[model samples]
Target: MVRFLWVCIVVAFCFSKWVDGFVQYSQRGDPKTEIINNTLMVSITLIRGAEAKGAVCLDGTLPAYYFNRGHGSGANSWVVHFQGGGWCSNITECVARTKTQFGSSRYMLPETGFTGILSFKAEENPDFFNWNRVLIPSCDGASYSGDSENKEAQLHFRGQRMWLTFMEELMSLGMRHAKRALISGCSAGGLTSILHCDKFRGLFKKSTKVKCLSDAGFFPDEVDISGEPTFRNFFSGVVSLQGVKKNLPRFCTRHLDPTSCFFPQNLISGIKTPLFILNSAYDIYQFYAILVPASTDPNGLWDNCKLNLTNCSPSQLQIMKGYRNQMLNLLKPISKSKQNGMSVTSCYAHCQAQYQVMWHADNSTLIGTKTISQSVGDWYFDRAEIKVYDEGCHYLVPQ
Candidate 1:
């Protein structure tokens, strides 16, 4: 126990240093921009009448999106992507969030680089390169599904309203006449894509081809290393504090609790729209935050392993394999669907579709011969039935 306590102290100090370095790095502009100069930067566009429509962010600031218009053969095609950041479960966390880009548009960068699936370059994003792309920021703290407000805290949980306002605004801007459309996101934004997939399809005419893609958003309701419901409890808090119950899918809320419905595992099967799921079998975020949180690993036994999968002990690797199997089992039902597509790789990373190397680089991560971009594109265009899974663990350092 004493050794464990010592490890904890060491880990804590290292974490503090990392956070400090991150702050300094952020001030210099997005680190990715430095590495990839060819990225296309798109400016933010705040909704004109969002405040009047009660479609404001957590701090009541106007909600916004970044858009890049399409051309030629893709002029009528649209890609709506949601920006992901972690959520705030309680009033204290929510209040803290209002000061950051996640909860308020005020802190967001005036312009952000669009890479990965949002990239406009044909070589980088072959299938959707020329398609009109829209990126909606997740600034309301509830995956764009909450609808209640806390007057005392001066918080506005109007994500649902904000989503509707975005749709209405985009329709007026040209989406209504789209020949094809796709809704996609990563992490929390990925959950938003799933939550609103059917609704997005309903917005277009029956002839318009529409589908949804969720990247690194399949958070399971499993117990942590300590056999405690850590993530479940956190999700429960978010649901209660944000009044998310009323907005959950009726089919799910009718049987399970609101917290359960928030999990993609319970909600994906019920989605009527064609959906594609892209996730890392050993998602790094889930490995640290959900499977073995700091509270669960007080001794810091997982400190090294969490940071680098290659550092894991044989026993730890076995445990991760079990977790991977669990995720695969949950995904079995969806894999059987001819209309749905999946790309579950054994990479120890999170949110792949948004990064250039992971999406379509020469050495990009792949299952069989298809890169992530190819898999998604093939599924989107019905070129093949993609239900590929990686059997061997590939501990590639996250980019």
Candidate 2:
């Protein structure tokens, strides 16, 4: 049994017109259809940034796509997705693949018709580029979470945080159409979904709603990625637990890490943005999984790939330990409030990007090792019992 962390892929390329930069993948779900059905994943390009069409931006063009399975038509709504990688380039290919697959929000909506904010990676300009699609401030990509702090690339770390804020701002800017607004992230990104939920809550057409599926963002409270353990990091160098206790009010889950919003803690009690959390049972995916699993009742967690990921590279193994710890710590109740209710309308992996679900040999473990408690399928309509599937490639069997 392998505990698969859905946070996974990437590569560097020349930013040339011939640079047809794109990612390819397939998503799986277990939906029960009356018969066999084929819903073509649609692409709705919300903002075609004129800059994307320029040579400076990319000798070719920057194309961002948001994939959707449309619903009934109305105001063209959107859901901005942030890909998960430890704010580094190690998994650039994986994250890029996702962006290429489902970057646009309106592409697959239930025909209710929606629009997506899209972007293309300028292989040369991974550091920065013009927003060719509707810039949701949500600049998507992954970064290395390694402890080595090279002075030359500190700018990348700084920009990672700022870009997350930028994406939330972008979502707020264009949230005028949707009936409600939601922020979702997987793995470390699951942390982003929580951190930005409250930040973007009131600014949109509706308050930010969150669906946290398998996440204990890198820093629940800021642990000095430099050396500090999670406890002290929560206090931002305040080594004294007494100091942390004193700052309990300010120490809410979201704010525990001075660097991140208290997304985990705030998602449930303090914030009104309804949140949904899913953790697998009998699985030790993260160090936190050792702390928190199905509890007495494991629900949506299909597989705990962390424990099973022994063969993962040193980088992957360490990532599993850190995130698992974050997940367990996060699973603990902040104020003791139960979730409002679970919804069936969930996307398994972070499919909010375009051209997602790349199940190639090198990265196959990234998806298959994880298991789902419920049946899985794809391109199907979801309602109250919407199934949120992550990783895993095989097309979902109609439940």
Top model number, lDDT: 1
By summed lDDT, which 10 consecutive residues of candidate 2 come out lowest? Answer: 373-382
For all candidates in order, the CA lDDT equals 0.88, 0.31
> Total clashes, candidate 2?
96
User: For candidate 2, what is the lDDT?
Assistant: 0.31
Question: What's the C-alpha lDDT at position 81 in model 2?
Answer: 47
Clashes of each: 0, 96
Give a tens-digit lDDT track for model 2, residues 1-399. Answer: 122322221122243312321221112321111111222223333333433322010011222324322122312333444444332232332233233322213222322111122222223111111122221222223211111112332211122333333444354444444443345444445555554455545555433232323232323432322233444233232112112222122435445443232234434455445444443311232223222233411552323432234334576446445654454455455313343322121122222222212211222223223222111111111223322323333332110
* Model 1: per-residue Cα lDDT over 1-399, one tens digit each: 999999999999999977754422222222222223666777788888889989899999999988777766888999999988978899999999999999999999888888899887789999998888888888988899999999999999999999999999889778999999999999999999999999999999999999999999899999998899999999998899888899899999999989999999999889999999999989988998888989988888988888788888999999998999999999987798999999998887889888898888888867878899999999999999999988644545553
Alpha-carbon RMSD, each predicted model:
14.4, 17.3
